[model samples]
Target: MPVTKLYIDKEVEDYSNVREFSSRIDLEGEIVDDQQVIFDIIQESSDPIQKAKEVIFLTRNKGAFIKKCPGTSIYTCCGYKILHIGTFCDMDCSYCILQTYFHPPIMQYFVNHIDMMTELDRIFEEKAIHRVGTGEFTDSLIWEKWTDIASKLVTKFSKQNNSILELKSKTVNIKKLENLNHNGKTILAWSMNTPHVIKEEEKDTTPLKARLRAAQKVESWGYKLAFHFDPMVFYDNCHEEYKDVVRQIFKNVSPENVAYISIGSFRFMPDLKQIIQKRFKESTLVYGEFIHGLDNKMRYFKPLRLKMYQAIVSEIKLLAPDVLVYFCMEDDEIWEKTFGFVPDKDEGLSKMLDKRVAKLCGLNKGLLI
Candidate 1:
């Protein structure tokens, strides 16, 4: 973490978790009644994005903690839920949609764990299979060094049987998660890409081998695992590179232990193009063959996306015939063209993933009724 300045929301200034987090960081913090003061300072910087990485804010979530994943009706959504724990990330990626998602993005960690847990309790009481993840808004495990949030959530979920908590990240911050009796309720996931993509696009993230090694360690500790190839870049020799990544995944961890694998091509909002041009000078990710998608985002041409998905899915099927592989925010055309069949519209992709979780995690009553 490159955090240098800490700001606390007046509402949570006296929170015990905030105090514990403050003590862990070697810096003095300022408590402000309003967040605009901190936002103003960051906006005045020459590089607001980089400046945001150097600051951390402690605050309370004034809204719902669990929200539906913002998926388009035109696309086949997985029916995933977002556990909004934070707002921004410490790492920098050239194709990150978050760069333009927030008006002025800043690293925020919500200290109101009670409110978050309340949301989880309601979900558990529903007794339906829900796939919730914290990585939707930010990297899930990035705050492990300063807080006990990971242990608390893992232990809390272990006692429940209806839902699964997916903590996705690009970091190898798993030392604190070791030896916990997670009881297969928490799935440790990683946002994976080829080594070339990691080196060229992702900044300040763990290497490919190191992340897989961390996955191997966690698998040895009796935790189910998941991997995602989201925002996959298009470049020369990219197909072979992605195939190698699939090979590396099964090589490091057992296929039977993998809960699921998700694949999606690189797509971005139009506003993010200028941000990448200004921030990442050498990036050619935005110069691909892009067309306006039905969701009003810039997506690769249909044929281009289909070619890549077919190649990658073929490799995954050949390697692990039984492992569950799904697409994230893709249309039925792509699904049918790649796998020869689209997931049933009535059940959608979410139920398919829930079935995989039940089989792998030993949850008997896993259907979403």
Candidate 2:
């Protein structure tokens, strides 16, 4: 979606990143003091949540830039670290948690590079392998249109030897990354869904074919690739559609080049249903055969989720037996039933991903980069 307006924080008016972004992002709307102020302003509006989507708030964050993901122990967590660059997304997916996550759901970008890098310095000093990603709070590359965030992050991670940066997105903003020297330390990932889901649910995102093509472009540029069939929407005859997506992925890029592929069925918090229903009146993707799961969120019936996961996992294994395939936010029981084993036998989810990083990107305990 085109940013119709810009909300600049007064504190960072002279900041270089702010100046750079202000020059590109359309500055055509009412300015607010900051993100919270913007939320307050929108609250009195006719539709605060909807209006919030039109404005982009630029501010300097006053917290730790890097933090551990809030993965619950109820499920086998991925143990991935989250780089909290920003919150909310530009895309209008039907099942977005941000719809109810924030009162107004403003698209906020924290422009404090010095502090962010300072925290990362500590992580880099640790000898342990840390797998970090920027997609936890927002679409990783949404800042591509307004700032040099992706290129800067890639460049920063390039010099690091232990941790690999995963930049996941639903957009095709690979222009800035195509020529960068990433040192094979950055995984260019995309959250993909079936073409039908893309068309009906993932509003304003790059089409499935376009996203795959973008991934192919980055793969040719020597960057490791990853994919997530996350929130894999369940619909009529989803088996063939998902299978087609899996095949097309390998067709566009080699399996050897793919670092990992994560498969997850559609799951959401109970509070999210009304927001999705209100925001996307035509969408029924959230109204599936859902039951309350261990995490207190509504999930597809275990047997149903197992069926879909089993089918997709089977197809992926048949095509690329050696590739690392895993589930996102799923429990050990689901893993055992579907894959015939859990990740516990092989260290854990975090170490497994680290091993994938070491094997695919050539990082190891002996050699850093």
Candidate 3:
């Protein structure tokens, strides 16, 4: 195992629990890696864990576990749910929001599992059919190379009947998930992009074929699977590329085995354009026909967005019409234009998605539609 060298913020070192955790990790009198940089923001924080939670560092934040999702109201359009985990990613996607979303971007894991389970138990007791994911802020399975967090979560969530956990990632790290006692309460999701996008924009991610193969392995393991084609970047021959990807997915995994599929066009905050230019000069995704959205972020022109969504949805529908398909952070106009139905007409989008998820996983017993 490659040990993660954690740097305890000076201010947090005085806490008994923090001290104990540091001792367990052998933090004292250890030589720092020449490649690692020491971050001092934690030293200035009164509650180091809370501050550490917001900042991504190479250290483990041994603090309070679990957190509320910081999603905007628009998150409801895409089945918003609480993300107990914070920002941490190993793959380097050029257009990833985490580059700017987290200060001092580094991979940090919160090791306080007991408190997290307690909080989840309370949330699950509400019996509200909540949909929660660890992938929202981070690639859910990226940490598996270092920690068996997904296995722990899968085993823990297997016992809960009221909530479902979605582990979304672009890696083929399903080894940690094999032979787990999953009760169909967890969705092992994969975030996919066109082969061109994967080659150009995403770095250190598993190949699309490998990801689909892994999804098939999970399906064979009796686990529900999900797929997302988020940030569907538009380029020359994008339609053909995306269509090929859909075909590949259907060929590898049956639609019946897929619990849900989500599609979204490329959208980015204006500031990210400069960051991409500075860090990833070769990326052309920033050069698309973009306009400032209502949220003052740059997105595809409304018509282009609608066209891309329509095309991708049509392709997915052709392969798996019955699979639960939805958009991420889109509005009523876009929804109607693409799917021909407003989320409002049905119960809220979240409930509709949750119900579909329940039915797919055989958990819809008395589940509210």
Candidate 4:
């Protein structure tokens, strides 16, 4: 559903972004002091999650905009920094954790660009290899129609040499990025899944072929690419299906241009089980073999996850041996069994990614390049 209602926070009512977005939106925005009023309105709907997507709350980000990924202690972290651009997405995925992550699950876009840029300036000044992304909280390209934030960010990152900005999304809004002077400082990424999974579980998303076509377009523009096969569902012939996805990825873009590819099996918090049952009544994703993991979430049994990972990793290595392939949240056992080695404990996965960034993005971090 498109955004039909707009709510502007009283504190950010006078910001320039508010005026620009308000003019672009055909609907009249209602300026409000308390956000509870919007929450109460959404609570009365039969489907509040769907209702939340229909309205946007533009507010100031009173806190820090840059934050570290909240990786669990038991899992290997990628040491990525999150540029908290917004909260919640417009698309509806049956297995989306955001459905139960936020209270009442409202869609919010922060209008405080001054504060956001100030934080990014600090990151650019530091002599470090930083992988920053805006897709952690929401789809990175969903705001392209109403705002020029993506263009602004890509331009700013182009002028720097210490960090790379990654824009990950399921949308094909690359028209604005084509003419930018990114200077190898921006990476375009996608969250890829099988056609069966996309059609059944993911809704209101670009099709698999369309997303790949967009990736090809971005590659032609000379940008480094990344693909993530996350939440890989377990089902009959799932191994073959995932291998096919790996095949399609290399078929579209060269392995030499790929910065990294990550694989993670389907895992969910216990609270999300009920939400999936209540909202997606026909979904069988929760029926797979599950066990309580170290982080207290329900994950596929280790053997099952290992089987899938081995098949997928073997296919990727066969096709693109030099491309970096890593697991998202798997443990040492999975790494040792699948790849015959584990990352060093001190630098671990983060160091591996930093080296890739320096080599591919040409950052002078004193690591690889």
Per-residue lDDT of 222-286 in model 1, one digit per residue for the tens?
A: 99999999987788899999999999999999998899999999998889999999999999899
- Give the CA lDDT, 0 to 100, for residue 121 in model 1: 96
lDDT of 3 by residue, 94-142 (tens): 8888766755554565545566777778877774677788987788986
lDDT of 3 at 245: 88
Better of 1 and 2 by TM-score: 1
Global CA lDDT computed for model 2: 0.85
The residue pairs that clash in candidate 4, if any, are none
Give the worst 10-residue stretch by lDDT in candidate 3: 29-38
Q: Which prediction has more favorable TM-score, 3 or 4?
A: 4
Cα RMSDs of all predictions? 1.1, 2.0, 5.4, 1.3
Candidate 4 lDDT trough over 10 residues, lowest sum:
360-369
Compared with the true structure, what per-residue lDDT tens digits does model 2 show for residues 122-181?
898887888889998899988888888889889998988888999999999889998898
State the weakest 10-residue window (summed lDDT) of model 2. 26-35
| Better-scoring candidate (TM-score), 2 or 3 | 2
Off by over 4 Å in 4: 367-369
The per-residue C-alpha lDDT of model 2 at residue 193 equals 92
Candidate 3 residue runs with Cα over 4 Å from true position: 1-5, 8-37, 40-69, 74-76, 345-347
lDDT, model 4, position 354: 90
